[model samples]
Target: MNEYFIDTNIFMYAAGKPHEFKEPCVSLLSRIQSGELKAAIDTEVFLEILYRYHHINLPDKGADLAWSMMDLGLNVLPVTKKDIEISLYFYQQYQDRGVLPRDIIHAATMVQNGLETIVSVDKHFDIIEEVKRIAPSDLI
Candidate 1:
């Protein structure tokens, strides 16, 4: 099974509507269910998902969804001192290069783990070379 780190947008798309990528999103979830693909999610992605979902007024349900993903076997990457240090380094290095804190954390998580694929719809990953970004549409 190939392991992939999930970015927050994939979850949002799977949960929210615009419904353009519904099939692909469902396929990704199904892959996780069958254990063909190992899905990794970091604390930063978790916080972003909660914040964005609540920001859109889905407070109670957003939290419920977050917990559900965890229960569904999404591996939560533990935050370590090294992860923080790398994040800080990226914050300074990419500050003028237009990097967001959350993105830096995500990229750094991939770097630390030697993972190269990210399941995300966010284009910020395009700026990072450490991972290959796979969006929900690709799965569809």
Candidate 2:
């Protein structure tokens, strides 16, 4: 019953090209869908997924994907004002490490939710001591 924070890249790899990591991503998502593994994604992650789909001229597809995740009962965490404020703190703390604002937001969301594990392809999460970033393959 371990809940993990899911990052946008995991979904992107699952929905995008047939890369080496695609199968693992698909498997991990399938596990989540089946309630084998619990997961939560924040608004920022959802927005990023939607924006990517729209950027690729697949807005409808993106919307469908987002809805499907919701339909599957995935916990969607809101990016609240408090979360944003905490993100600023993370931004300053990790500025020397070259962390992006979005990553800081993700980190803040996880911290706020007491989540210490994340499923992501982004290596930047590696430097965040608060969360353990695992690749999809690790779950599979």
By lDDT, who's the top model here? 2
lDDT of 1: 0.80
How do the residues 32-138 of candidate 2 rate in per-residue lDDT, one tens digit apiece? 98889999999898888888899989999999888877765689999989899999988888989977899899999999989999998888899888789998888
Those runs of model 1 whose alpha carbons end farther than 4 Å from true positions after fitting are: none
Error of 2 at 92 (Å): 0.6
Which window of 10 residues has the lowest lDDT sum in candidate 2? 65-74
Model 2: CA > 4 A from native: none
lDDT of 2 at 101: 91
